[model samples]
Target: MTLPTITVDLLDSKAKQTQKRQLAKSLTKVLSETLGYPDKEITIIFKST
Candidate 1:
């Protein structure tokens, strides 16, 4: 059994796109692992607003 996908809302008020992407990827990887999901299967959406 699988649960519905989750969403994270993060904003880069001062960070650059590169930095945001890096953080997003790292965060997603850790979250997936913590949530018992494969890191590679993690999905992350980064936004700056």
Candidate 2:
């Protein structure tokens, strides 16, 4: 089965690189644990608006 892509869009927001990475890591972990999906199978896309 194919998992859906997770896209995060920041609208007129400014965030540091480290912050983004940490957010991604936290999100991946939480999502994986809660949804029973492997970390490697999760996809996170960050977009600047």
Tens digits of per-residue lDDT for model 2, 1-49: 8884689999986899999999999999999989999898999999999
Worst 10 residues of 2 by lDDT: 4-13
Clash count, candidate 1: 0
> What C-alpha lDDT values do all the predictions have?
0.66, 0.90
Instruction: Pull out the clashing pairs in model 2.
Output: none
Task: Name the regions of candidate 1 deviating beyond 4 angstroms.
Answer: 1-12
- Per residue, candidate 1 scores C-alpha lDDT tens digits across 6-43 of 45555546777897678877777777768777766666
Model 1 poorest ten-residue lDDT run: 3-12
